[model samples]
Target: MLSIDYQQLLAPIQQFLQCETPVTWLDVAQQPAQLPILLTDHLICELKAAQSAMYLIRRYAVDEQSGEALLQWLKPYEDFTYRQQGDWRALADIKLKKSMIPKADSGFGQELIDKMVLLIKEELHHFYQVLEVMQQYKVPYDKISSSRYAKGLLRHVSTFEPNALVDKLICGAYIEARSCERFAKLAPLLPADIGAFYLSLLRSEARHYQDYLQLAEQIAGDAISERVAFFGKVEAELINAADTDFKFHSGQPLAFSAAVGA
Candidate 1:
């Protein structure tokens, strides 16, 4: 089994997230008192984002028609969390599969499948945990605008066949890596309870990033370092640049004082 040098990557990951954490988020994160609330929101975003990738795989990258099924699988959780149309007890009963994609003779397929399945499972579990925390803290759920981070990086994808797929997978790698990095950066700044939770996520999150990278390599069958660097630059731009949205992955603060000021 292939393994990632998680400890080795920690420093770089930390640097990426902390580099441009926008002065805007500092105040919110510094409020150790509100760490629980902020972290709860962060966790939900992570799960939903991961679920999106799962659907992408089940839809475009995998069996092609499994996309609708993937949506159905996530519908309950989405309705409960985002739409508020379902109950928590209903979510507890939801049993999404660990691996919707199967293994193949190439070894590449199975490796990607297994790793991503673990990621989706962990992400969904994290979502549930966030809801639990929110319920305990009496925090109300609200819809936040989509972050520019993912879209910015994704825009660089080549409009071709396997090249597009390869680029998308590479973009996935950066997203996962950046998320792991952000969690590490924010952990120490958070309250003890939330900090512990963030630290706990470091292990699996780091592995998830590596998993995406490996999948990119397996599919491309060549040196993806240039491609990786290409997306890294794009991703860094999205993070280092200014933005109006306030999200877990949003860039510079847009002065939307309404959300923070409120």
Candidate 2:
């Protein structure tokens, strides 16, 4: 029932990313038996996305008090996800108020807080939504190993200050863009409800990537095309290379069929 211009939404994402999600990955992802692993990994990815945004805000924008508050806001999700000690139903009521985050004095601090706050909210909510979907489908969560996709990109980050932050942001952009692109391409091949849910994420995922790029450029005070392109190649290599771990952000599957629904 969702209606939007798919072509227009995905055009920039397609352009930003150097390569598409492999047919082999999509083929494995859409298999009916892979639901548990897909949903579980997706749940973790959402929490991880929120955590990344929180890290950025705490590191670059917010005061210590604000950072701790942000952690408290996300603690329930972490407990449920990692510690396995919470009622998922209660998550719906756990919310972060705008007033809770006290701004600090930093270059582009307000902007970073604003955009990352938005991204954190959405990612957390999407985490809840994924849990809801899993509950409906009776998919149990699982603790799985991390994939090399993110580490591959992070390995090349500069050791310097501004460059380190900028590199991370560019990597963030590539990650978000790739996620959006994959969601779009995989939606139609899945069940209707799941497909719609995946498609629904297109707008925010697209915006998150753009916001990362904008913030990176603002912090860099110069064009980041060269660095962005470098991360683009790195991200593409991770996406295209053979990967053994099958997680939400995993690369091409090597022997992941038996590991499905982890």
Candidate 3:
């Protein structure tokens, strides 16, 4: 069981989320057979999170050449995750040098670069950690279709420039907050070691959500409560409604009733 208080850990997340994760999802999550899929999705989610942050920085904060360098920095991990071309060990010595990107002229640009770079670093580290845990459990990595949860929220983003950026940040905040909330919920239910690992991730995940929210506010320079509320409702719908697929962030499983009937 987790040593920390879940309510305290999840307070901010709960406030941000419009709804809680359904019990049906939790029931499916507790099944032993679900471990492989759960962990695999988790590993992928970490890498994807890093990739998203990198893209945000590269597109808005860095110059063209620097953007290419950022791609090069991420190539190996992407290759490994997508094609299984290299082992996770190859990622150990890789370092993101400061010279890869030029200094930002605007305060907003500098802040985005700084925060997103740190986020990428931490996410990749967490990806490595998830891979290690999968190795320990003999869980093989296989590509799986992404859950609808993210896409559902992303579909609501405005196509306009600053609005698009603000919306993406808001979406990021929701994703991170949901991740933290789920980690707190699942930690105590898992085995001791795994539970401890999940608990350990709570602080970083919470901070990540906060970082995204702060960036959104900074970029908007005005009250973003309306947009935030919009995404919250979308996120809550994705969580509360029935989902055909089971993934790390998927909603209530449609298979639940079938399993019960069987």
As for model 1, its CA RMSD to the true structure in angstroms is 4.8
Write candidate 3's Cα lDDT for 64-175 as tens digits. 8878878887888999999888889778778786554544564588788888888988988899899889989899888888999888998999999899999999999999
lDDT of 2 by residue, 1-262 (tens): 2245978888898898898888778879888877788888888888888998899988888888888889899999999888898899899998885454546458788888899999999998999999889988988887776677778898999999899999989988987898898888878888899999999999999999999999999999999989998999989888988887777678888686445636
Measured over all alpha carbons after superposition, the RMSD of each candidate to the real structure, in angstroms, is 4.8, 2.8, 1.7
Each candidate: how many clashes? 1, 0, 0
* Per-model TM values vs. the true structure: 0.81, 0.94, 0.95
lDDT of 1 at 216: 77
Off by over 4 Å in 2: 1-4, 97-104, 256-262
Best by TM-score: 3
lDDT of 1: 0.67
Query: 1 or 3, which is superior by lDDT?
Result: 3
Q: What is the lDDT, from 0 to 100, of the residue 109 in candidate 3? A: 84
Highest-lDDT candidate:
3
